[model samples]
Target chain A: MKKYTYTDKKDTRSGFGAGILELGRTNPNVVALTADLAGSLKLEGFIKEFPDRFIQCGISEANMIGVSAGLTIGGKIPFATTFANFATGRVYDQIRQSVAYSGKNVKICASHAGLTLGEDGATHQILEDLGMMKMLPNMTVITPCDYNQTKAATIAIADYQGPVYLRFGRPVIPIFTPADQKFEIGKALMLNEGPDVSIFATGHLVWEAIQAGEKLAEEGIEAEIINIHTIKPLDEEAILTSVRKTRCAVSAEEHQLNGGLGDSIAQTLARNYPAPLEMIGVHDSFGESGTPAQLMQKYGLTADKIVEAAKRAMERRV
Target chain B: METQQLEQIAVQVRRDILRMVHAVNSGHPGGSLGCTDLFVALYFDVLRLKRDDQGKVIFDMDGRDEDLFFLSNGHISPVWYSVLARAGYFPVSELSTFRKIDSRLQGHPATAEHLPGIRIASGSLGQGLSAACGAALAKRLNGDDKHVYVLMGDGEQQEGQVWEAASFAPHHKLGNLTAIIDLNHQQIDGPTDLVMNNRDLGEKYRAFGWNVTDMKGNDLADVLRTLHESKNDSEVPTLILMHTEMGYGVDFMMGSHKWHGVAPNDEQLATALNQLPITISDLKDY
Candidate 1:
């Protein structure tokens, strides 16, 4: 197993904020609209520096989405920012009709995704966003692993036209990926190469997969770790390629097992490559009040959970 | 175009709407007929369109320097399609394809087919105003003085998104925008007043910091005057409360919510077309 270390720990939302600020300095058409989560989304620097480009949409997520769709008509790329719950479930129709259906160049940036939203409880933690966004035609759903990758993904989606749902998080996590990593939409990034089991993970769960790979090495288990940032245009080729060699798979994400990264990978495998699989995620349940660390353990989204799933998948291999 | 010419266009447009809905056995002929004159006024006279060297209307997705129109209440697409076709955005013959399979003339207006003149897709109500506000903001950012117009149903104001947009445009001072609410007082279920009392609609917008104006939407001259007067790049947005009939030309379909989304039958279509005159640019030629 390859050794990975991080000196800096930052919330994925900060990467979004940094990416927008950097893009603000570079791209003139980069406009930011927030539904009163400017501070939480870490958009202060972008707002302060490029005040003219920032639209304060108050608490109206629906209007924010509509406006973002509208902004694209005048050659402006709009990034509508809000919490994951408000960004997806609350303003779904607005996004469906205006952004996705209309094929508008709008970035639906969501922070505080999954149980890690913590303390705010299950209402704020959105587990169904990936499915909701992925199902919409002309929509690109990207949930990057860490701060650097999130930042790179944010900058990259600006270049790609059409609707995009960029899901990030609130809690600070280790920044393991390179600061200058070139983020490619719909392309899988291989974190580690092993022979026993292929572990496909997304968002915060990618780091857990990496940690699980280290643990599996101690028990003479070689685990292959693959990072799936783009969930909609699922890199089926990568999953097929890695799984064909490993012959078994374990999928992990900070989302529901029913519709998250696991379900997507499962469908891909069922269609193209049939293999033994174990999915690690919230099993048709809601979250509760707990710290980010406590929630991960309670919800089975930790390194140990990934290791367990990987072992289960390997045992089921035919 | 003169007021008389605009009136002729309105008659042809109403005829087009009837024929379109009649052919498909589906479409909203009532609101389409009701909004015919307003559509004629905007497409023919008021909207500052961009054209090619051949005098053809050039449809650009990024309608930066052109006056953009968004139909938020998209069920009335028949009227808009008729007007757009007659104004040379597309061929007037294509109006026959309304609600047909693989036609750019969708049941509701959409940009998915790369249709000329439509910049946004709208059928679900109360969304267009927010989009218009966004385009207006982008125009303001780009230093473009062109205006954006969006039309919504009276019943659509019942949507919370409408009020949110009403509050938004004013707060952002989107003077480059004008939102028109069809004051026909009818929706899908029943009268807007009966379904959801949008009590004092003008008063609500006024309190939301809009410069509200009333216009006779069925009258071409009045629609022209109001649209021209409302064109501004001010700090305040304008709201035109367009008073129109549910079905203006067709007497039987007039003033009833029942005709809102229903297409005109054979005899009904003949009777409705009889009420409107055939213009110089005949629909048959297309």
Candidate 2:
């Protein structure tokens, strides 16, 4: 298995902040609008640098979305930031009609996603955001793994035309990817090249997949690991290639098992490769107020869970 | 255009609204009839449209230097379509395609068909003000000095997003945008007061930090003068409370919410046409 290390840990929202600040300096048309959650979204850096370009929407997610859609009319790229719950579920119709159906170039940056959003409980933690946004015709849904990749994605989405839903989390995680790595929208990065089982992971689960790869190596089970960042436009080619070589796959994500990355990969494999796949995610349940570690552990989203799923997939490959 | 010429166009626009809704058998003509004069005045006299080399007004989606208009109360699309065609945005013949399959003139104003006059799709109510503020901010950012106008139904103020947008404009100082509410006091269910009273709407907007004005929307001269006066420079945004009857010109449909979305029958259409007598100088029918 390929080895990986991190010198420091940082939250993905801060990566978004750093990226948008850079975009504010580079792209003249990039504007930021937040629904009274700039500090939580880590957009203070962007606001400090370009105060004129930032708009405080004062707890109105729907209006912020509509305004962002309107800003696209005059060729401005607007990033509407809020919690994942508010960004997707709270103002879904607004995003659907104003931004997605209208084909407006608006970036919906959501922080505090999934079970890791800890202590705020179920009302604030949204597990169905990816499914809701990905269903929209013109929406591109992206959930980067770590800080570096999130920053790269934040900068990359500004240049791409059309609406996008960029999902990131609150907890600080390992920054495994390179700081200057070029982030492609629908491309998967292969972390390990092995023939036993292909492990496809996204968001914060990418690091757990890496850990599973290392443990499987120690147990004489060589696992192939691939990071599937962009959920909507899934890297089908990469997934098919890895699964074709391994004959089995394991999908891991910090979302529900019903309509998330697992469903996408299962659908892809069911149509094309038809391989034995095991998924590790929250199974149609809401999360509670607990520490990030406790919540993730209760939700069965650790390295051991991925390893177990990988073994089950390998065993089921008959 | 002269006031008499504008009034003549408005009569033709009322005729077009009646005919279009009558043809489709499924459209909102009550608010459409009420807002016809306002639409006629804005398109014919208020808006500074882009002209081509041949000195004809060019109708395209881009509204950078030109004044932009959005119909929030999009059920009244018949009036907007008529005024837009009369202002040379498209051919008058397209009015026959209202609510038909594969037609640019949708039941409500939509950008899905790439219509030049519509910038955003708005039938959902209370979203147009946010969109207008966004466009106005864009103009400010692009160094373009132009105004953005949006029209909403009086009952649409009951939507919470309207209050959200109402608070947004003044806080952001989107003075380049103007919002007008057609205060006919009726919606699909019933009278707005019986459905839900907003108390005093002018005071609500004023408390939210907007420069408020009232205008007689059915009166062509009053609409022209009030709209012109409200577009003056100010630090706060402007809201024109336009008052008119639900069915202004037609006596049968007037002062009632029953005709809000109901289409007039053949006999009723004839009665409406008779009441709004068409002139040769009024409209070149499609």
Best by lDDT: 1
- The Cα RMSD in angstroms, rounded to one decimal, for candidate 2 relative to the true structure is 1.7
Pairs with backbone N, CA or C atoms under 3 Å apart (clashes), candidate 1? none
State the weakest 10-residue window (summed lDDT) of model 1 chain B. Answer: B277-286
Query: Mind giving the per-residue lDDT tens digits that candidate 2 earns over A1-318?
Result: 889999999999999989999999999999999999999988888889888899899999999999998888788899999999999999998888888877889999999999999998999889899889988998999999999999999999999998999999999999999999999998999989999999999999999999999999999999999999999799999999999999999999988888899999999999998999999999999889999999999999999999999999998997
- Shift of residue A72 alpha carbon in model 2, Å: 1.6
lDDT of 1 by residue, B50-165 (tens): 98899778888998788989999999999999899888989988887789898999999998998898989999988999999999998999999999999998988988999999
State the lDDT at A245 in candidate 1.
Answer: 99
**Best of the candidates, DockQ:** 1
lDDT of 2 at A287: 88
Candidate 1 docking band: high
- Which portions of model 2 miss their true places by more than 4 Å? B59-62, B280-286
TM-score of chain A of 2: 0.99
